[model samples]
Target: MIAQSAARHYANFKGLPKGRSELEESSLMARSTTLAFSGLLLAAAPASALARDYLVHDQKEYRAAAGAVKAGDVIRLAEGEWKDFPILLEGQGTAKQPITLTVQTKGKVILTGASSLRMAGSHLLVSGLVFRDGSAPGAEVISFRRDPRSYARHSRLTEVVIDRYNKADRRTEDRWVSIYGSDNRVDHSWFAGKGNLGVTLAVIRPKGQPEANRHRIDHNYFGPRPPLGSNGGETIRLGTSDESLSDSANLVEANVFDRCDGEVEIVSVKSGANVVRSNLILESQGAIVLRHGNGNRVERNVFLGKAKPHTGGVRVINEGQIVRDNYMEGLAGTDFTSALAVMNGVPGSAINRYHAVSGAEIANNSMFEVARVTLGAGADAERTAAPTGSRLTNNLITGQDGKPFRVEADMVGVTFTDNVTDGEVPGAIPSGLRKTGIATKRAANGLLYPTDPALAAQGAPRDLRPVMVAEVGPAWYPKATGIAAFGSGRAVPVKAGGLEAAVAAARPGDTLKLAAGHYTAEAPLRISVPLTVSGPRDADIAFSAPTLFQLEEGAALRLEGLSITGDKAPRQSGNAVIRTSALSTVANYALEIDGTAFSRLDSAPAFDLIATTPGTFADRIAITKAAVNGLSGAVLAAAAETEGKGRYAAEHIAIADSRFEKIGSLAQILRAGTDESTFGPELILRGNTVVQSGPVMLGLSGVQSILIEGNTFRSSGRIAVANSVGTPETRIIDNHFIQTPEPTVTKLYPQGSPRVLVSGNSIGGDAS
Candidate 1:
């Protein structure tokens, strides 16, 4: 972004004062010059003094070739997996002719497994390379500076794909791209599955850096970035708390943010003079938040929420901000996550805290829902200052006629002028926004445009269109998705052979249809991809492995209609029918076992039917229409390492329409008592028939919510459920007990939490 045109664009933007034009000038210049600049940076040398191609096949050769790099020189890497190579390159080139570092062929070179790319030079272009299936050697996947003191200027990274290249632990923080230096660009790359900690892309101003670090990020495809379950999950972040008052002049344009629900702030702008425009947000349950910056513009972006929960448009805070010409619809967020939320600021706030909004403009935008527009958002103690000297002007809002706007602040020093809405909004002046009947039709580009001549011009600029998958990211990426599944659901027939080998060969999302024969498994069946192994109930596996099956943390597996024996399970306790790998300490899990049966050939009597390791936990464990006869372990179990302090392991445990006969104690299924975390450590045991089970033991310490309904317990039964120290909800209804022959009584509630509903059940010969 350090191009001359980019610098001039900032100076040329209309209505922006001297310091405010830095971002606008750079953004419009990047959109117009990036394509032509790509051609210039990538074209072969001009048959002049600087033109040469250095083809490197190894780390040693690349180092030697980089030393001699010059203007218009092409340093090409051989096509294959280059593992653990740190390609730190630096060179100088002219604007007309740049230094090129690329692969022999597009999308063919794989730089994976601790490999990295760092550049510190002028007019450099890095393209057509992939980094995947491994983590970076350090914190950043790619760095614009070779070191802290040196940085790359006026460089470009395009057609590069970083897919599933991550560490096993989700807490390991590392950004995919970290921009430094001045006027650098990253475009047309495919970045996905950034499940680990850190922002997907970050623009940083290292110490002693220039005032305006103009960076351009455009036309990239940001794929499914699953929630990080904590802070530091923004898909793209600009600047930081320390640099809040400085001008970044960063430009983010025409990219597709797909399902990146990592945190409440999708694009956290923490610095000043940045422009975010023409971007499309699809089903991501967060917003572009002007969290700490001033003199920032959020414009021409299309937010298509489709009523998905938590989806938002833009949230404005700080000062001298403009939120304009954006089209938002079907957003279902409120307060801080509202489609357009102007927040209350903390008085005399610190650098990291929210500051008061002054001289802010929210103008010429269109919204289809009332929940989308929220004024005076996030009002609480210590944040008593409301927005002052701000205007919401000439915007169009269409929603329910009577639903009142969320007005938390008193709206001091605020003006609502020439704003139009179809409803009689309670917060806004009724006379200012005249009511109208607005109808819209889909344009050729599949976007709705207003039929009313006046309203049509009030929303986002018509020139901005919804970004398609093809327009962003590398052309050769295998998958393009917002929330696409892990696999394509294709079936690969499993012939008579080693089932382990077959599982390794199968692609992700593929279903392996097992043949009705003896499949030998001498090792743990390691499933590192999403797969479904299906067969009839007659199919069996003679697994002599440490564990029957081991799964990569994010990988999902479905076992259907098969039989397995677990007597060979190791006494050292690697025994698990399906266990997540310990390589990753923590992550969410998806496991399904349907119509499958387990038989132990020996009398071990102690086994783990399904288990989780110490630090790892599952979000949802669903076992439906299955039979675990002669079971020796809990259906699901994990250690409550931090028990009684609030955090229990799993989110949801569901075992439905199944049968458990001759099974051992299920006390370890859920034992964390009085967990404070909401939405789970919940268990749903419905429509199951238990015979000769281990007394139906749910110990004194239990889940937050337990529903044991429509179950038939015969000969030995009682339900003891509660949160000893915390309040819990337990519903035991519509169950039939043939004989109440169990030893323990069916009550475990403590003094604090006594909300257990045990109704509509028959304890004797009657049915309730």
Candidate 2:
């Protein structure tokens, strides 16, 4: 009976004709006026008068009231901070009136700090709740099932917000919403700021359950998921690789993805027989990858990449995939992230591996100024099978490189007809895309519409204007930007007595001017926001705690014109006086120290001035007009790697007009191996004085570019180039090593003709 009611409700939602049972009152009214509980004396009052409504004040009251809640009952939780509340709304309701678990007033209740909800049983509804500023105790913030034997069907979750519910460690895998069961719908909601390692929302079909879930996810806002820097960071995922052959038949439509640069797959479709249409992707650096699915339809979607780096469209990987009528503009990715990629498949593959593309259709699409449209992409040794029996017809494309499309492998049974490009259509993946000189007309919204009449008639009507996430979510929820800016745009003054509190209250982009006095850092200060601490030259700090300052993700600190003295316990690595957190966000950080002095008391194994946590990196670090005297290890060590893959931390490090006397090596900026697809390992050192800093000053390895000019080294060791994995570009000119009997530069590798440019440097009191 409940399944019949679910079918009837879905039919009613689809505007289908009412059968002999249901009342045909109107479309606006979702429910019929039918009650079947022996009428209970047959009152002519509305269903609300007969239905029970409970106002719960606390968890004990809620637990007491939950058992007695019946069909058509409404449980309204009062507005407050519902922290650590484990909510379970388990009941049975008819299709017309679902058991509602909602807030007393909309947008007023906050569920935070280990709160989770599970809606088990049939015809349940949950709405108007906000999960904010806390992490869930479990893997999911809200699950649609309680246990293995019980789950929610005909359920609806609407008008909700999950904003920045992150664990302190972003590597901790947690999801905002996980859906199971069938005929469920999630709409008009907002999910944002998932910096962790899981998909934001997932339609999960666990093993031993092969039923088609048939979930509808529509009209929601997916906002600002920054790169997790690893896999498993998709915004919406349909199913798992283990359930790839099962037909979940999910529908994802009318959604907006804004700046979701989690991974190369933004919306990962791993289930079969799904419909993905009418969605808008804005500046996300990933594709809607049909990763392990088959017989899926991708149509009428809009990809406005805006020429951002690595933004893409659709990627086809399986059989019977139909991609058509999509309009894309300004995409800037290539190869695997092409605007439209028809990929090669693994031979004799498992269900988890890539299936070969067969009987695919690519038709009636219009692309404007995209980077590439690759066919048979990733055709290596294992994925040697080419896409066969596919039709590429009636598509219009204009590209930046003039050649929009390329064929990687042999086109065995593929056919191309009536396809037009502004550049030459390529014959091979690395080769030609022939220019047809086709004259095309642009639409009013600045996208190319199809010129062929049959292709034009085949296109569906869609709203082509760009959609902002702010338009669909609840009106009270603010649209979150990817990089959070907490600055109040005001300055604050700090004294020695109030330094810690001032640092704690300071926002990003703020400046704290310290008074000229002595201070003691007895407790470690963790600075996670970009702040500047400036003081006069007479100001000095004594460090007694484990590292006076610890840098976190996206944080940058500037120490200006201050003196520092530390007598901390001796440590070898990963324990610098200033260090990034090992569990920081996988994003860039920066540090700048200018006109500062460092003095170690009692020579207690002088700490490195600044070091990064292993596997974390800095975008930039600048040290100018600074004087330091240290005892041992590398002062700036950003050279940690993942199991010696030779990954370095900082992108650009520049030290100019600084004096290092009686200290250790100046900087060890090393990237071990050569992978040219990544960005910089660069350095700039000029006009510095190094005196009596023996053995090493600059330990360079796999550095792409460096400019070492106009410095004086007094009897210090040479700047050694250790690794020749990449063509290291080096320039050492016009420096003076005062009476130092060592060669100025040493190339460690035996690779011939290292690109070191050395000239006009005085070594051992003679100009060379």
Q: For this target, which candidate reaches the highest TM-score against the unseen true structure? A: 2
> What TM-score does candidate 1 get on C-alpha atoms?
0.73
Tens digits of per-residue lDDT for model 1, 97-148: 5778988877789987898899998888888889987889899989999888
Supply candidate 2's per-residue lDDT for 296: 88
Lowest lDDT block of 10, candidate 2 = 33-42
Q: Pick the lDDT winner.
A: 2
lDDT of 2 by residue, 1-768 (tens): 443343355434422222212212221122221122112112212354566778898899999878888777778899899989999999997675667787787788999888888989987877788998688898999899998778898888877899888776655688889998988888778998776668899999998787788887876889887655445678999999888887888878767888887767889999898888767898988898999878888877789899986789999988898888788889997766789988888888898877989999988777788999888876655677898889877677788888777677887567877666778755442322235554556677656665656445433233354344555666667776534332334577788878889888878888888888988877877888888888888888777775778887667788889888865534433346688886756455678888988866225453577877664667578999998876465668766654444446676789999988777778877666533222346689999988876576777777766888999988677677654432356788898877554334555444322367788988776322
RMSD of each candidate relative to the true structure: 7.1, 8.0
Query: In candidate 1, where is summed lDDT lowest over 10 consecutive residues?
Result: 10-19
As a whole number from 0 to 100, the lDDT of residue 113 in candidate 2 is: 84
Clashes of each: 6, 11
lDDT of 1 at 263: 66
